[model samples]
Target: MTTFYTVIDWLMVFGYWLLIAGVTLRILMKRRAVPSSMAWLLVIYILPLVGIVAYLSFGELHLGRRRAERAKAMWPSTASRLNKLKESRRIFATEYSPVARPLFQLCDRRQGIDGVKGNQLQLFTTTDETLKALIRDIGLARHNIDMVFYIWQPGGLIDQVAESLMAAARRGVHCRLMLDSAGSLQFFRSSYPSMMRRAGIKVVEALKVNLLRVFLRRMDLRQHRKVVLVDNYIAYTGSMNMVDPRYFKQDAGVGQWIDLMARMEGPVATTIGIVYACDWEIETGKRIFPPPPDVNIMPCEQESGHTIQVIASGPGFPEELIHQALLTAVYSAREQLIMSTPYFVPSDDLLHAICTAALRGVKVSIIVPRGNDSTMVRWASRAFFSELLEAGVNIYQFTGGLLHTKSVLVDGQLSLIGTVNLDMRSLWLNFEITLVIDDDGFGSDLACVQEDYIARSTLLNAKEWQKRPFWHRLLERLFYFFSPFL
Candidate 1:
């Protein structure tokens, strides 16, 4: 019996390898990047069972061929809008803000966000303020309200927003909501979607999860966009999720849920609305393409001297706009670079950029949460910090609360505020959006925010970090070893 059991186990191992080899051969034949394919191959070859699990989790691209075809078909329309925005900016060159020029060009060349004039942008600093503004915008919508969020839960502030959305739906306002199936599973499984649907709101789940679907598609790539576009004129995008307590916390009221949200009106809003429409069409198979030509393009009351461009990223898009945009902005920084993110995992390229910048005399500072929610990620992040500190990059850990803001202030001239975090998943895996603003005033405001965080946070000096216990360092090393998956 023992001999028979051993033979069966060996046969199972052989079957697994055979499966992995077949998939790898197919992927290679499809001409996927050699490095990526090789990496996957290595995982499967070395740790057969675990590699199969990891590959199933994060290997195959999630979007099916049909969805890819749809995105390709829609590319022309997106490109046309981008070209129009580019031409409009050129025609109004003198009217365009100088601070916004680099960002506009960066967006056009990188992320495809057109710089539209006469748009107002308001920055909200807290979740309460963000929710209040979001609810107000939803309530005031005249034509349509489109929202796409990673997490949309019921009860508390989110429930209030849901009620308002339902109310708007009943009033004949076209209300459509899209939530990531994976991120909002708990909410959807609860009474949220049914409750909203009964109130006349249309809700679609992006990427439903099933065992077979899990085998065929990657579950790690998520639609992590938090956007609310109303009436094709006003839009909201940022790090804030539509949930009570902002995010899941055990204490429920342990810390202030800090976030940064931006309200925009102009061509940018239309751009945001288009993003929502594209996602909606993809998920619901209902086309709401070609927004109305008469959508308002009014100039906003200016509060900052910076020019702003909105950059959107997703699996449907080939270019990694947010990541490239950050690299470009950081490389362009002359004096100082300050960034704050809830998650601080960095890609090798980003890590190089920061280290190189700091070494070159650019004062680079990064503020991250002291106690991150993920144990592995926190340990992995710490593993990278020592090198950065050694390279002269200043590190601060926010102590007051969960620092859930993705913001960067560069040289007091360029400011980037949005939903993308400084991590591998955000940069390469998940869909994200960010606003790159070219304004002295916006930079100044961001600088003030950074300074305030620094004042409250504890700086991680190199010596202090080096003095941590051996067990902690070993844990960090263990976490770092598996960071490629993390």
Candidate 2:
């Protein structure tokens, strides 16, 4: 009995030393933000074994060598082949408006394009309409159809898309489907990929997570982009996944999700296609050249002049430029800034920019779901609401449904739309695409959508929030401590 007691005591002492050595190595070898490093250390101090295991599994980003190599390989081709676009001098003739210039210039410097001119965007507010438009475009494919969806669950409107892809493939219009391995796991295990394969549609699953893969890559890192291009003329983006939102989070009790998608034409369509091509190349190591010169490029209308630029960010990029871009947009806003997203765990930089925007009288309003799919994320976001509300940013809780639209409107003139949620997963862990548009006409159209959402949302009362139960505040802050990882 005495020997057993001594052995256990020694084991505890050994584990304590081990924890210290591991943390020392992590601090010296791993390059992480100070807050993140401190957060991990705190976890280690509180729950030694659990924290070490968690840090080992989730700490270092290892999305595999192919992920790093794919970005390196694709950029040169992107630079040389697609960079030669002869953007018309009409838009550039007049300097970007003061409100938009900083944001546009930031984007232009980070991504290699000023907004592609002569573009048109058709916005869809519901899942049924978005899928209808997507199926319609897939049906019209002549040259090829390219699709990359993070979540491709098999049901609802997914069959329509599947049928369209199979039909397009059968008719010799090439079809390529790429779905994230984790997000689309059940789809891969189901008959969807097999059916598409049998029908001649090339299918690739991005970043499969497995026991062996845990060491080879960051298991949670995802490709959360949703893209579809038909021939070389039309493209679609924004928050709508292929599945119907009515069933998207049905189990979460959030009724039909309110989402938005933008169907694009003209040069922007080709730009979207090129962006898709980069992802396809990354996943399959096959290059998709800018189409044969014989294929016609859709030109925007002569009278209407709108422009869009595609910004894709993920583990592949050298830096998280998407985070900086959002910050720039917020900081550049002068009049009104209305933003909507499902999840809202923002980084320090984003949080500061938003608070500063509101404090400086930008009339900042952020609309989010009253209830969300993830309880953890909801709690973390709740902690920030108090700070933001105190800083003058109006927090609107949507009573209508889960607001899944991720868009930023600056001075009621520029609109940004895509898969990026205002959260850490979007900023660091997932591959995301955001479309930046500089046009008042389109902004007004998008504003009507935002206005409709605002009508359905309730402005949060700051004093009421402050009066919430002590337990509620404690739970929210506890979850918020994990925001960097969330």
For TM-score, the strongest prediction is 2
Q: For model 2, which pairs clash?
A: 62-217, 62-218
Off by over 4 Å in 1: 1-42, 83-103, 111-113, 251-256, 290-296, 299-306
Please give the range of 10 consecutive residues that has the lowest summed lDDT in model 1: 90-99
**Candidate 1 lDDT, tens digit per residue, 1-486?**
999999999999899778978866765775544545666777788887788777766776667656667777776777776566555442122333443455567666665544544556788887778888888988898888888889876667877788889989989998888889888888889987887898778888887776676666677778899998888878888888887663467463437656778887656676676677677666666677646434234433432223456677776775667777788877877789999998887877788999999999999999998877678888989889989998999999998887888999888877888889887778877778887776676677778878888898999988878889999999998777666556
- TM agreement with the true structure for every prediction: 0.89, 0.93
Best by lDDT: 2
Candidate 2, 306: how far from true, in Å?
1.4
Candidate 2 residue lDDT tens string, 229-317 = 88777888899777867556678887778889999876677667777878878778889875622223433343247767788888656
Candidate 1: RMSD over Cα atoms?
3.6
TM match of model 1 to true structure: 0.89
